[model samples]
Structure formats: C-alpha cells, structure tokens
Target: MSAPITVHRPSPTGGRRVTVNGAIVGLAHDDRDLAEFLRRAGLFDAETILDDPRWVEWRGGRAHHYEAA
Candidate 1:
C-alpha cells in the first residue's frame, strides 16, 4: 500500500518539489492541479509558506498563484 503523504514547500527559489511518504515528487512551476493534490493529501503548510518570502510563488508567474487567501 502507498504510504501517507507529507507535503512541504520547496526550499530553493524557482525549484518546486513535493513530498509524499518521504519521497520527492517534482511540481511544475505553474501547475494548479499539483497544488490541489498536495492540499487534498494533507501535505500543504500555509504558515511555513507565508513566513518565508523566497519560497513564495507570488512573482513566479501569474499562472502559478493558486491561492486566494
């Protein structure tokens, strides 16, 4: 059986990646579905994201801002 997923924001600038069951899954720079997948899988960390400016995708691309809050 597949292990549970634990998502965390990417550490590098412009280098997006996701974690699932201790495994890494690369994410597209502007893939909205990828964002949803992370959220649904209980891997998203909002507080950690807003606390770090560099990891923010605000300026990456208009198509990448998947959050409205």
Candidate 2:
C-alpha cells in the first residue's frame, strides 16, 4: 500500500535491521546473505519474484509456490 521502509544498521555491528511500523520484522544480518534475510523477513512478493533463468517457461510459477503456503 506504501513504499517499503528500510532500517539501516551499520558499523561494528555490521548489519542492518528492517522493520515495518516499528515492529521487529527483519534483520539484514551482515554475516548472512541478503537473500536469506529477505526470505526470513517474508518480504518477497510472489507477483514480483521472477525466475530470470526461465521466466518464459515458468509463467506464474512463482505465484504458485508463494501461494501454496
């Protein structure tokens, strides 16, 4: 409904924290991969996630996986 909010955590801590409306939604851990952080945060939307390797072959496939859960 609105633009995504990004909470940046930098320095010795070496990571970022992302939240929605002050809720502890996700941690952009420096040690961990960004993708994992996003997945854990449940940020990726099915409509936007694309399988670039085979997008044409997999039309709407991402929606199926995301919707299944």
Candidate 3:
C-alpha cells in the first residue's frame, strides 16, 4: 500500500502541495509547514514521521526540496 501522505513537487514559485488520503491538505514550504499540516490532520510527532516511508511519499523531487529548478 502507498503512504497516506504525499508531498508533491515544488512549484516554480516554491512550496510543495501536500495531500492526505488523496485529499488536498495544504502547501508546505518547509518542515515547519509540513508539521503543521500533519498536526491539523491529527498527527502528533510529525517531525519524526516525515521521513518514514509508511507515513509519507515524496514525489517529483527529493524530500525537503522546495525549490523548482
């Protein structure tokens, strides 16, 4: 099964689109923003879970990369 959370590629203006269970959550420019999104989604310890494959799936670019090139 795929991860429940997906961090899409960064846009030309920067920031990545985040989704949960196939529904749009918000745009995250950095780890802080991502943690907040997860917090709103009822996920605690989001920082520790960010790199966990079972929790998040990074796409289009490497994880934590928010600059379009």
Which digits, one per residue and each the tens of the lDDT, describe model 1 over residues 1-69? 432433244336553455545555555344554555555656476344432444433333342343322
Which one is best on TM-score? 3
Top-lDDT candidate index: 3
The lDDT ranking, best first, is: 3, 1, 2
Which scores better on lDDT, 2 or 3?
3
- Write down the lDDT of every candidate, Cα atoms only: 0.45, 0.38, 0.94
Stronger candidate by TM-score (1 vs 2): 2
Output the worst ten-in-a-row residue range by lDDT, candidate 2. Answer: 55-64
- The 10 consecutive residues of candidate 3 with the worst lDDT sum are 60-69
* Superior by TM-score: candidate 2 or candidate 3: 3
Candidate 1 least-lDDT 10 residues? 60-69
Q: For every model shown, what is its TM-score relative to the native structure?
A: 0.30, 0.35, 0.94
Q: What's the distance in Å from true for residue 67, model 3?
A: 1.3
Candidate 3 runs further than 4 Å off? none
